[model samples]
Target: MSEKEIYQRVEEWLSRMTLEQKIGQMIQTERMSITPEEVKVFHIGSVLSGGGSSPGENKPADWVKMNDAFWAASVEEDEKHLPIPILYGVDAIHGHNNVLGATIFPHNIGLGCANDPELVKKIAQSTAREILATGVEWTFAPTLAVARNNQWGRTYESYSEDPEIVKSYAGAFVEGLQGDLKTDSVIACVKHWVGDGGTTYGIDQGDTDISEAELRKIHIPPYIPAIQAGTLTVMASFNSWKGDKLHGHKYLLTDVLKEELGFKGFIISDWDGCDYLNADFHQTVAQGVNAGIDLFMVSEKWKPFGESLNQHVNSGNVKPERIDDAVRRILYVKIKYGLFEKPRPSARYWSNHESFGGSAHREVAREAVRKSLVLLKNENDLLPLKRDARIIVAGKNANDRGHQCGGFTVAWQGVSDSMDEESDEPASKITTAYGADAGVQRGKIIGGTSIWEGIKAMSPKAELNINGNMADRSRHDVGIVVIGETPYAEGMGDIRQGDETIAEMATKIKGLMKVLHPYGHSLVLNELHPEDLEAIKNITNQRIPAVVVLLSGRTLIIEKELEESTAFVAAWLPGSEGQGVADLLFGVYDFKGKLSFSWQKKAGENFRKGDEPYNPLFAFGYGLSYSNNTEN
Candidate 1:
């Protein structure tokens, strides 16, 4: 349909919708909280599968069946109301990562290091296809956060700290995910609008204390390209600008994004994002609506939120014109995406089991993993190891698929093979009727090759000693130690203040003790995961040439680890395709990735492209390759 036709349809739908229906169109609920019948009765406009929230077997077919139920409910004709298709969204940020067997691509941090916009676009296209296979039409992805501080937990989600790199990748990603807004594509949401990564002390959802000029220069540039690429939605950030929360920031949400920049699509709130705006629910609804949020991702609170929004509108706290505008935007996007004309979720053009974790998608993911491995240290040219060399793979991350994928894989905070006895993190709690055991069946649970598996694939004689212990050390030619941060997301991954004790940090994170470092609150690579350093030391002490492959979300204090290793590779969260890491190690592929973020020498040190007294362990854009014969 043409632009005029889309607008005419949007206006026609806006004119007919009741106040409740319009409010429903503005609300997005989590699937677990509201039933399919509830979605129809309440006229809920959107539904989402929050991180690990899945239906009956958590398979592609299961997702299609579940979405089909919701689709049927939404379009079911009744005497009282008109039928409107509900939009189903997911955090398919990496590669439809929430589902098992789906090809998990390199996280955004790794992709940033690859520095290939075409590759990122291909990954986005594969991600969209996989998401469509599961019957989801929208994805909350291509996180445009320009992370300034490495201490932020979600640094891995950002493409780059440099806004120019982020700006370059944004349009390509949007274009890939939303190809002409057709049946095979999914709606792309460029996210956490403005300065989510520039928070104070690198705190997740903390205040971004910067001048508006600095904000535009560093943070807002990425969104311009994304908007230009015709992204259909923008998720509001959880963080505040200076002291003002973004959910209620009328100037940025309305005046800047919608009016000045000309974002035609809807603006959405993050998970319970409005609740952070005000103490009173009604006030939050009013403030959020007046601030120009087109949709509320209320999660479980959709009904109460809808009721509150209705009351706020009736009491004149929120203008009817604002409500109509919000509804119109929602309807416009729905129509533009061909949601109104499409059949049920199962009958969609791209929905099928073959596309979920297909070979072609996994191959793209493997190429991404190969391109993303940033070789930091190649002293004496220890990498490009012979395939026949006797290898000893050791460390916590060496054999763990969950740790390799990191956070936002299968679960909200991601899954881990090793769970602390005292901690009740998401990894321990998640079960999909696939299995009850967490550690033993974790590989099958998330479905990915560990670095150990990749090594064995190439060299079948390679021994897997996870703890780095060997009775006969002389048997191994080399020891490959894979180590880094375990699975964590948001506040759970934040490098706490130096003054804050582990006990205090644990209390703040609601007793999630697994994430707390026993030593101190710091970004030291060893301190956070001491066993990693121990494993590396165990191998190095035996005079074995230790090849340390660090799988982390961001640059860490790695001076101690670097000192103990012969060759060090900063493999930033290579997801599902550990063979790619092996490819670099075994000479099948050379290292191509450069440092997306500056490698910090000290813990909690803040350094960027233009910082004064700019001393880093390794500068930004640093990498080593066998072809160049470079050493760092």
Candidate 2:
């Protein structure tokens, strides 16, 4: 529909909605919190599947069935209600990652290293298709964080620290995700608006203590292109700017984003984001609404939030015009995307499509993995190993799919096959704390080939010895040691000084003492997985030409590991398609990824492209290929 037509419809719907209904339109609840009947009775506007919240069995058909029920509930006509379709959103960050069998793509950090906007767009396209197959209409993806510090746990979510790279990729990602809004598309949400990656000491949801000029230069540039490309939604950041929480920052949320940038779509609060604004629930609701958040992702607290919002509006705290404006924006997007006219979830064109995680999608993911593998060190040209060479694959990450995918995979913090055996306790009984196991069935978490499996598929002579046991080194021609950070997200992945025990630190790094920052914090990688270095040493010490493939979310302190390897490749969280790593090792593909972030030489050293004293192990944009030895 045209702009005039959409506006007319929005106004018409806005006129018909009651105050309670309008407030309902502004609230989004988690699927597990409310029943389908509650969705209809409460007139809820949106529903989402939080990271691990899935339907029975979590298959494509199961998702469709679940979505169909909710869709039916929302549109069921009644005397006091007007039917409005509810938008279903999920965190399909890297492919439809939350669902089983979806083709998981490399995390944004790896995509940034690939430095191909077209390839990123293709990945977005494939991601949208897979999400549609599962009956979800919206995906909270294309995280536009200009991550300055690698110590931040979510550095992998950022495309690049350089605004130019993020700016170049933003429009392409939006275009690919939205896709004309006619067919095979999902609503794109360009997220965590403004400076989520510039937090102090790389703390997630911490303060960004930068000047407005610096914030615009380093962070806000990416959102301009995303807005220009017509992203239908923007998620407010959980972090604060200059000690002010963004959820209640009226100037940035209203004056800058909606008025100045001309963002026509609705602005959404992150999960329970308003709760961070004030101690009182009513005050939080008032502040958030007045600050111009169009929708609130209240999760389980939707009912209480809705009731509180109603009281606030009735008491003249939240203006009725503001409520109308929020409703207008919501209706405008719903109508513009044809969500009102679209068929039920099970009847949609791509619903339960056979190509969900099929060969074609996996091929695109493989290409991304191949393009994203950065050849950090090719000492003596040890890479491009012969396919028939006898190989010994070692390291914990070598055979683990969960570690390869990293965080935000099947679960919120991601899962590992090597994680402790499933507890008999129900998933509900498990705590959602930082390091707590959420009772994930590791065996059924993901569907993909491990690095060892991929290598073995190409070369039958490959042997799997995860402990790096070289009982007979003479039989092996080469060793492939895959190592790096395990699965973690947000605060759980932060680099801190006191996290490791003294004995644990010593055992991980034999003679080297833990490198502490001037402030007594440590950003060392050895403490996280010291076994990685041990495996590398075990192979290299035996005089085997070892190739170290590091699978991590961001750059880590790897000087010791690099010193012991013949060749090193930064395979930054390559998802699902392990064969892509094998493709490069076996000479089927060449290394193309460059350093999206500068490689840190030591623990606790934070440096960017233009920072002073910018000595790094390898400079930004550095990579090597078989044909070209020169760095870009």
Candidate 3:
């Protein structure tokens, strides 16, 4: 639709909405909030499920029912209210990540290594299909942060440290998800609007101290292509530019993003994003609305937020023109998505489709896994072992299915079950059903294969050892150690946020580096577990030529581990398809992935770009292949 037609339709709808309804249109409540009746009375415009937030059973059908309830209520209105449909949003960053049994594709870090825009677009399309099957219509994804620092907790969310690669991906992913915005397509929301990946010391939501010129050069280009690709919504970042919170930065959010860049879509606040504006609620609401945030993602405080916004507008703190603009942008997105014409999510034709985690989606995810593996070392070609060779696969990650998918799987922080005694399953054949409760088991990995499962399938004689304590190490011709990061997301992944100094942070990380690191629903953000080093040291001490497979979201401090290993492979958080890792390991597929971020030799080192490169352990785009060719 043209700008005039969109505004005309918006103005026609605006003519019927009261101040209370307008305020309600600005509020986005969570799923666990008040009942559907409350949604009808309040005229809530949107609903979202934060990480791990799901309906009873966390199944696709249940998701459809839950979303349908809210959507039904929003459209049920009297003559006093406007019967606008509500938009259901999710963090379907890597597939419909919130839904159980959904196909979990490799995270963006792995996709960055793949470096294929067409593949990224296909992944987004598959993700949208799964999300639509569960009745969701909007996703906060294609995070366009040009990560300049790897220590940032959300590094995996970014595609690359290079702005050009990010620029390449932003539009492809948006177009993939939005897919002509007609059928089985969801609203593509390009996120964390500006400079979230450039924080100092890789702090999460910290300040970016770069100049406006650098910001325009490095951080702003991705959004331009994404916007041009017809993204319907953009999320405001939690991070600040020059110490100013992006949620309240009118110059960037309004002048740069909307006016200067010509982004016609709406700007939505992050979860409680305006809370950082000020202590006073009304003032913060005014700042956010005036700063061009169209939707307020208020989780628990929607009622109060709506009241405050209404009061601010009534008091003239927020101008009517700003309110009209915000509402126009929001209504335009809803209209553009055809939400008004379609019924609830459960009523859509694609809802409850059989392709949520069907073979086709899983195949795509498996292909992504194969393309995401980066071989860091291959001393004397230790990999591609004969199918019948004797091998010992050790390390906590070797047999752990939950660890393979990493964070943002079934739960917010993905399942982190260790290979302990309690998890031992009978040596039964792999099961097809990884029910809602299925996770890592002793002899059988659930939901997906582990590196050990892959190796054993390729070489059935291989022994699966988790602790590396097998009595006869000399029995094995070659040992493969699968070890790396435990699952993490957001604040829990931040490496240097709270510590006063680098030494203090390193000391803290070292203290938690042992077994059973504190696990929580949210607050824990431990760095790469140190047990990989201990396991490698143990394996190499026995003179076992070790080939280490590092399963992590980002490159870590692995110089010590590198010293003892005969070969190394950077198997980034390959989600739900362990056989792909096995395929590359056993020469079923060549190592085609490259390093998206410069591999750091030290924990405190900064991220390296190709230009003005630093002395990284490995440069950006570096990777090894079985053909003995190193690509950079």
Q: Candidate 2's residue-wise lDDT over 1-632, tens digit each? A: 78999999999989889998999899998888888999898889999988777888889999999999999999998887779999999999999988888899999999999999999999999999999999999999789999998777889998888999999999999999999997788999998997999977676676787999998888999999999999999999988788788888899999999999999999999888888775677789999999999999987889889999999999999999999999999998899999989999999999999989999999999999999999988877787898889899888888777788888887777877542223322121211322335564536445568788899999999988876876256898899999988777776676655644333433322122212222124556576677988898888778887899999888888878888988889999999999899999888988888988998888767779998979988899999999886685
What is the lDDT, from 0 to 100, of the residue 223 in candidate 2?
Answer: 96
Q: Which pairs clash inside model 3?
A: 423-442, 424-442, 425-442, 425-443, 492-525
Which regions of candidate 2 deviate over 4 angstroms? Answer: 418-437, 440-442, 498-521
**Candidate 2 displacement at residue 509 in angstroms:** 37
Q: What TM-score against the true fold does each predicted structure earn?
A: 0.94, 0.94, 0.91
The residue pairs that clash in candidate 1, if any, are none
The TM-score that candidate 3 achieves is 0.91
Please rank every candidate by lDDT, starting with the best: 2, 1, 3
Better of 1 and 3 by TM-score: 1
Which digits, one per residue and each the tens of the lDDT, describe model 3 over residues 1-632? 77678778988999888888888888897887767888889988888887767787778899999888888888876786668988888889988877777888888999999999999999999999999999889999989998887666688888899989899999999999999787868999998989999876666666777899999999999999999999999999987777678899999999999999999989999988888676777678888998889999987889888888888888888888888888888899988888888867887888999988888888888899999888888777787667777788888888776777777666666775455545655332211112133343233223556677778889988887776777155587778889888777776666553345344323322111111112222211123456777777666777788889888777777877787888898888888778888888788988889988988776556647755647888888899887765564
lDDT of 1 by residue, 1-632 (tens): 89999999999988888999999889898887889899889888999988777887778889999999999999987875569999999999999988888999989999999999999999999999999998899999989999998888889999888998999999999999999787778999999987999987777776788999999999999999999999999999988887678888999999999999999999999888888675677788898999989999987778889889889888899999999999999999999999988889898877775867878988899999999999988788888898888899888888777888888888777777542224422233343212222342333335557788798899977887777877146698899998888777776678776634434333333111223222226888777788988998888888898999999999989888999999999999999888889989999988899888988888657789888989988888899998986743
Instruction: List lDDT for all candidates, in order.
Output: 0.85, 0.85, 0.79
Question: Which regions of candidate 3 are displaced past 4 Å?
Answer: 1-4, 418-446, 471-473, 501-528, 610-613
- Scored by lDDT, the top model is 2
